[model samples]
Target: MKLSSFLQYLDALGLLDLIVKLKLRNSILLVIMCHEIGKNVYYEEGIPTKLFEAELRYLLKLRFTFLPLCEALEIIEEEPERPHRIAVLTFDDAYKGVYENALPIMLKHGMRGTIYPVAGFVERSVAHWAVQIGFILRNMKTPVKIKLESLDTSLYINDEYDKRIALKTLLNMLPRMDVDEINSVIQCLTQFLDRELLHEIQELHERTMMNKEQLKEMAELGFEIGGHGYWHVGLTNISRERVRQEIESSLNFVNAFMSSSVCKLRTFAYPYGLYDDNVIGVLKELGFHAAVTMKPIVNKANNLKLYEIGRLSPYRFGLMTLSSFKVQLMRVYT
Candidate 1:
């Protein structure tokens, strides 16, 4: 079996937790990354609000210190010898579910996290193309053939399993394609679906992202509202000028609402966890203090990189189970 798979097997047998605790040590930080938070079938991969609270309680039971992303990074940089289990809770996409559902549980725990909002998404009331695609596939009611000229491929989706495969196939191609190409694929797929469903995109977006007022409230509440790019596109694939514009636009949007807040930390999370050295340079030029990536690893004090900080997702293989979660912590923390 693969190493992670093997570890998960042990975790299922309730054997991994003891091993993790035995080898657990101080001086490491776990930067946990999350996305949508609600019980929406269309967003099947999203962590449910109840499960999120359970995860928080699990970490608290383990005596993990939850802090904002900036504070956690500062500690990793300046206090390498601190004896505690440190964690930074972060959410990407600024989904409405976060404000509607996750906020109450977090408030109850006295916890704070970083909120990475896609500026264009919040400003224009448009869902990211990927999110729209997900909604389309999840809500598919009949068999359909999706043709992608860009990829020179076609997928015949009939059942839930087939839909899952097609969704995975398209998402896998997103990182390699530019913004236009990704949008093109989405358009083609949506056209294949019913026209009535096309109108749902706007409704989906409105339900998917936080409105300006909600975002302002989050900032005022002291959550680190960080940038996730204006277009939510991968910066590494775009021109340097475009990259600068994307990052700058996002920062400006965040700063506009955060003007009244005391939290002024400038941070970013790479869209789709994709970035290169050039992207990092643009972020630095744009005055961002640090950026987080989707890489799953424990961040030790000595090895923390400001621009390439690694983050772990709560969902494993697009689903979150407490057993799998414990195993993930074990694999990284030990």
Candidate 2:
């Protein structure tokens, strides 16, 4: 990211609020947002982005899960048994780095957390959509941006797959986008987008997902595996039947392969936190233990809908959360 772009991104109000609200001076309960780091191994420009290893030692205490997962788990266990509050470490996407980089760290620390995976990407064996997009961004020469119909900034894409992924992201995030408008925009994108490029990327990242043996091993290590839906599509757009199918099919595939009963993957982090009462109701009927949403509030077991625990997201860049966590810890606990 250019210096100017980075500065502008930091100026985002949502980002600012997230940092400020994190100073929970009165809260006894909390959770940490642990992210699965994407490729730092293969970037042509000497690593496109990174969350400096040093940062882990700084803000995150036993809460950091990279090199010190075991310690984090110990912290949880050592907490007072009041149920007043506990900090659970969680990683959103099961990136390949979870295996290559994170596993060793987790093992050394003996920390256990849930790995929420997009089912088809692992079970059926396909490259994750995000990884494919990142590959193109890291590989492309000319900086490309999608020319949108009404958007202000030109869509920035480093490669073809990035262009597709970014469009999909916008489609999912922008709720009021009508199908007619979507179709037109997608059609325009197809004119310059390279399907083959995305396909190649897909092939590469499928190999990146843990093979059956590795996944089974993850279970053996005592880490919980949760479903993050199949295809990782915008859940709000699909029909009720389709949602059930995605949820159940992925659960079936993982559960059956494990030689254990997943029954149903009630524990979910909604695809982009998009959920309807109807969608959740199906999960209730099916019997899910718990489901997590991307809501940014502390969750109470009694007040929650069971299938809708809120979570905090770790920012890609910033110092606010680090400093803020300390302030919250000092003011409230003392």
Candidate 3:
């Protein structure tokens, strides 16, 4: 067996718990990152509701204290003891599933999480381009040939797997293309699918993102709302001026919908977890408390930078079994 599979087997057999118990006594802060939480339709970006609940229950059983990102930062700084294993739950892309499917589960456990919304998608009630691309490709009835003139690449999506591969390729290429160019590619692909069929797919795909009222309601429920950029564009690929606009606009948009007593737009999560020194400087200038990245590791308090805080994705936790999650927790500290 491969090394990773062997390690997973060890985790599944519950052997990794002994390592965690023996080696990791010191307090460590873990920030868990998730994109969506609902029934997995595309199976590309979400953890099913049952699996998510299981993970939360497992974490609570371990006595890991869940905190808001801002509060977690304060505790990590002020509390020298770090008495408990600290965890901060954050959901990216602000999908409606988070508020609908995930919120009730979190509330059952008396837990709260941070959500970062793509301002444009939230306001317009549309999926992010990346999501739209996936939905279109996944729901396509037959093989379709399309050429991305901007990237000078052509693809034929023949089946579900081909659709997945095409979606991945488009996602990697979109961040590097101009906004208009990206839209052109999407428009070109849409032409190959029937309009009514696309509409049918959208209706069946009930995982649309949260609307403004839902966002406001979530803020009232003690969930922190953060910015995920205006257009969900990669900051590093865009011009610095565009980066400033994206940051300022998204924060302002979310702040307008939030009550200061419940939540404020104080944090930012990089779109696609892509950033640069200029992006960090922009966030600092905008007076953000902290920013999160998609990095997969537990953060150490002593040498953490507010602007570039790393987060661990659920896939790193091994979503199939609780033992893998435990192993991931230990693996981070070890």
Candidate 4:
């Protein structure tokens, strides 16, 4: 098993707490990475809404102070010793569920968080590839053959399991394709399936991303808005000019939409949490204050970098019990 999984197993066994108690390190700021938070039929990336609420209550019970991402950054810079334990909640992709489901729970707890939305998706100019894939897979009635010329492979989906496998393989290959390539692949897949029915299904079930008005409301309601690129493509693998355009254009769109004092678009979350020195330089040049990655490390005042701040995904912790959550936090603290 992977080391992270093994650590989670140890945490489930209650050994991680003992290890953490023995180490006794200083308190640090933890950023929890989330995507969607609701009942999703096609995706498992999201935690159920009730479980999300329970996690928040559990954190509150532990006396962990929840702060907005910008506020957390300011505190770490201005007064590092103010809070013993603090966390910033952040969500990516700006799913409608976050606005519809997660926001209510956060407000109940008197907490605020950050959201990074793909500018293109919010503009309704592009559909999230994953959502599109899920719609196609679930709507397929008969066995179909899918030819992925980019991967030089042909996949046959004859059952639910085969459909899932094909979906997974397609998702894995999407980040590398450009806009036209991705659209071509989706178009090809749609031809094999029921295009008219799939469009209807997509119209009904696949409107999962938040629109501009919802995002505006979220910003007005004390949530920070950040950029997640224009097309949700990996920046590190793209050309330098493309990286600059993606980062700059995304931030520009977010700033124009929110237009709130509290919702300054100064932070960015890299697509797929993939970046390099070049990507960092691009963000720096664009006047962003900080950028977050999906790294498993905890963010401390002394060790935090503006460009490469690390965040922990709750799924990585195997969020089955409170003890497992504690162990996840401990993994980052050390």
Worst 10 residues of 2 by lDDT: 41-50
* Top lDDT hit: 1
Each prediction's TM-score versus the true structure:
0.87, 0.63, 0.89, 0.88
lDDT of 1 by residue, 166-249 (tens): 888877777677767877887787777678877888797777778888878877777788899988887877888989999999
Candidate 3 wrongly placed segments (more than 4 Å): 1-13, 41-45, 80-84, 198-207, 257-265, 317-319
Candidate 2, superposed: residue stretches over 4 Å from native:
1-29, 38-81, 137-199, 206-208, 257-266, 300-305, 316-321, 324-334
At residue 219, candidate 2 shows an lDDT of 61
Error of 3 at 323 (Å): 2.8
Each model's lDDT comes to 0.79, 0.52, 0.76, 0.76
Give the higher-TM-score candidate: 2 or 3: 3
**Cα error, candidate 3, residue 3 (Å):** 8.1
Location of the lowest summed lDDT over 10 successive residues in candidate 3:
256-265
Q: What TM-score should be assigned to candidate 4? A: 0.88
Q: What is the model-wide C-alpha lDDT for candidate 1?
A: 0.79
How many clashing pairs does model 1 include? 0
Alpha carbon deviation, residue 51, candidate 3 (Å): 2.0
Task: Find the number of clashing residue pairs for candidate 2.
Answer: 5
